[model samples]
Target: MSHLLRAEYGPRGRSAGASTWHVVRAADPATALCGRTMDTDAETRAEEEWGTGLRCCQQCGSLYMHEVPHMEGSHPYS
Candidate 1:
């Protein structure tokens, strides 16, 4: 089974203070991982085992978590 986690960030670069929602695959929903606290510099990170981890501004960063689901084909946003 898989679960999804939701994270909210301030913003990044030009689009600072933007809001974005990210859908990530997880092994268990009971696990409190990303919701604990906000790591300012945690824009990029490595996952442990069950799933992947990301750190970026949901609104203004070059990369975002909310864009994961809408992506289609070999490339995203063609």
Candidate 2:
């Protein structure tokens, strides 16, 4: 089944490569800011850089995010 995901822009931190993009489950798109449930590790990706925010999956109550474009491939963080 297709799930509704929300993308929020995270600010850069004091450390380098700390900026991230968060993707959370929109349980109540009209009212829910993040999600009502927590995600199991199995449902999350290892490469995701988590910050302060809530995420959930409709099917498993899980959440994950993709690595920043510059952090992936051969481009290194400077």
- For lDDT, the strongest prediction is 1
Which ten residues in a row are the worst by lDDT in model 1? 41-50
Please provide, for model 2 over 1-78, each residue's C-alpha lDDT reduced to its tens digit, 9 standing for 90 to 100: 123333332344323332322244334333212333332221332223334343433222323333133345665543
- RMSD in angstroms, candidate 1? 11.9
Q: Residues 1-78, candidate 1: write the lDDT tens digits.
A: 233434445545324532333333344333223343433332322222213334433332222233343335656545
Tell me the spans in candidate 1 whose CA falls farther than 4 Å from its real position: 11-18, 28-78
- Model 2 gets an lDDT of 0.32
Please list the residue runs of candidate 2 whose C-alpha ends up more than 4 Å from where it truly belongs after superposition: 12-27, 30-78
The deviation in Å at residue 63 for candidate 2 is 7.1
What total of clashing residue pairs does each candidate reach?
Answer: 1, 1
Q: Which residue pairs come into collision in candidate 2?
A: 57-62
Question: What TM-score, over all chains together, does every model reach?
Answer: 0.23, 0.21
Best by TM-score: 1
